[model samples]
Target chain A: MNRNAPGYVLGFMALLCAVFGAGVATVHYATRDMLAANERLNHNRVVCSAFGLPVEGRAPADYARAMEQALVVATVPDGRGGARSVYRRADADPPVVGFTFWGMGFWDRIEGFAVMTADLETLVRLRFLDHKETPGLGARIEEAAFLDQFEGLRPDWTAAPDRRVMIGPAAPTQAGNRVDAVTGATQTSSALMRFLNEELERLRALDWTSLEFEPLPGSEP
Target chain B: MSVRARDIFKAGLIGDNPVYRQVLGICSALAVTNLLANTLFMCFGVVFTATLTNVTVSLLRRHIPKRVRMIAQVLIIASYVMMVDTLIRALNPDIHRFIGPYVGLIITNCIIMGRAEAFAAQNPPWPSLLDGLACGLGYSLVLIAIALVREPMGFGTLLGIPLPARELWWHSWTIMLMPPGAFFMLAILTWIARSRTGAKETSA
Candidate 1:
């Protein structure tokens, strides 16, 4: 059996693929539960953060307990054939809704979560999960200075699609929906503004009351 | 260690460094060096992949046909990198979130492939493993040095911890956090390292 022969080469390649494929599969399968738990913890943390719940310095178990006790989950049509999970605060007098939003950024896709008031007219809070923006320039979106602008700001849902929530040079008073964009990050600012406004519009159009929501595990049904 | 192993380590660390000397794997060197945490994880991923890939390639060198060795090497490298990614994602999701975008870059890093092709394909398994590790460490050394400067200057913090008396004297240098900052640091480091090495050779 010549090592260079076609049969030997093919056999070696097949063996290599089988061994490596199986190795990767086994590791992935073994870690599947841990990965899922990590993801759930992150989700709970994000939801907790979005609604201004205490997350910093809290344990993972605390986040889980908070999610189980304070939030309800609903699966809704995403307008793209897939269903997306949305979270609602169980006890907020007027209710608060949170959902993940993502869109193209300066260099890559930026993903974050947005929480809105029950009417979907005011932003409760915004927090990023992942972004590939330039570190000092565009990546500043994650900074409290930038993200805090969205909190308590009302989006003019009646305004045109593109003008619902502006992200640019806000007036000195900082009273309108317009928020100051990060300096020296025009491209990232524009891209964020577009996606965020689009997400706001989508949120406004959704019928929240009609969608069925199941009480989270450990919560009173 | 044997003299031969020492020589391999010396070559990987100083004589034929994958970053400053050989000028390989600059993409990740520049990309992840701005943040110390990111650079550390990137180094771990590269070291894990390079060392394992080298051992695997050397063990199979006799059986692997020359015509298709590249593909086999790649499959091995990719498998190891995937495992590293999975482990990091599972064990430390916070760091994973910060370095996640750059983890996939390990597959294309030239240092791992360069070692597998240049040394591992012909060497014994143990020597090849040493070479891979030395090269990975060489790359790590340069990246960690750059991150040490870049993070402090750019963010006025070390590993996100605010520097003591930061507000009194610290000022953020935005450029230090960008790619151009890496270019400057890499060039300066390479020049200093080469000058010292050149002087050593002349004196010897």
Candidate 2:
């Protein structure tokens, strides 16, 4: 147990290195391709989910194929800087402005991306993409019940994406807007409301006047 | 290979169970057991580190300097742990993410270091190797026991994958996968082991 000796130290070092070196060599040879493929797929799937798109069942080789026909990435700006949206399917005849949305909860961050309809007033689709919040408590943000609440949401005159959701049974204060928060997750809901406002205001400030609206393939009324 | 190896293996599995007996690797047992797959990976990592560390520590004990031996021992342990981390990142990166900092934390697991200082530094290489393997298996056994209950109860499934349609009948005890559940499970396990083995209070 005594630690001061030189020969003991050298011997220990040699034995330890020898054993670990062998382990590394074995692992390197066995798992090189699998790890690389995992990292690539994980990143791609998150991007797909960000746009309300799905990629769960597809194998790695099919990811590029999914991206080709399914998604469209557009650059949009926030107060912080510009953001992008890779919409799963924007069915509008003329595509409108797109935005990336995000929020902070008690434990971690929640974020997603969305594509708006041609008029810039209605939502194309919204998806919650990433979060690291506490399981069962804050993690409920990932639940479909919470996410589906955002499906038809749109702006009104008084309730700009500027004000936070007051939560706890406060009715939506304006037309074309709603505010029924998830039970036991008020703080998270409120934060989401605030972030959405900030993101929307930033979207409003952008100079979209010069950008041409191309008629989208599926934007039929 | 020898009777000693078998004895060491058996001791870890039954005589000196890590989670239920010594309760040595409880931190990971609690945190990762929330998912069966995570627990299984943690067990694999611990076993690998303990077995290899023991054999090396034993082989080198003769030349280790009295004053500087602890530092060298640490260097040895850290080397193995880091190597595990790198290989995971390179080979099994998905599991690596779930394992997170625990790979680095393995150096401080006390079990590996304990075996090194206790038996490895004193024993021959073969026995040392067996002791390491035994300790790892022992740790895995207790962890799997906890995982068996915790995963199924918390997530309403076994391991990361789901159970058969028949077992879908079980109700989820949501807390079984939480931190408090770990404490409860560990306590119950300790009680069971002590009562069954009639272990000496001072030793446990």
The estimated TM-scores of all candidates read 0.83, 0.67
The top-ranked prediction according to DockQ is 1
Give the least accurate 10-residue stretch of model 2 chain A, judged by summed lDDT: A212-221
- CAPRI verdict (incorrect, acceptable, medium, high) for model 1: medium
In terms of lDDT, the best-performing candidate is 1
User: Which regions of candidate 2 deviate over 4 angstroms?
Assistant: A1-33, A54-56, A74-221, B62-68, B86-97, B160-168, B202-204
If chain B of candidate 1 is superposed on the true chain B, what is its TM-score? 0.95
Query: Candidate 1 chain B — worst ten consecutive residues by lDDT sum?
Result: B195-204
**True-vs-predicted CA distance for residue B135, candidate 2, Å:** 1.0
| CA-only RMSD, every prediction | 4.2, 6.6
**Candidate 1 residue A140 C-alpha distance from true site, Å:** 6.5
Worst 10 residues of 2 chain B by lDDT: B92-101
| lDDT digits (tens) for residues B90-181 of candidate 1 | 99898887676667778888899989999999999999999999999999989999999999999998988999999999999999988999
Q: Write the per-residue lDDT of candidate 2 for residues B1-204, one digit (tens) a residue.
A: 577667788787888876677768777777777777777777778888898888877877776776666776787787778667766676655666566556777889988888889889999988888888888888887777888889888887775677677364877887896788978887888788779988876755
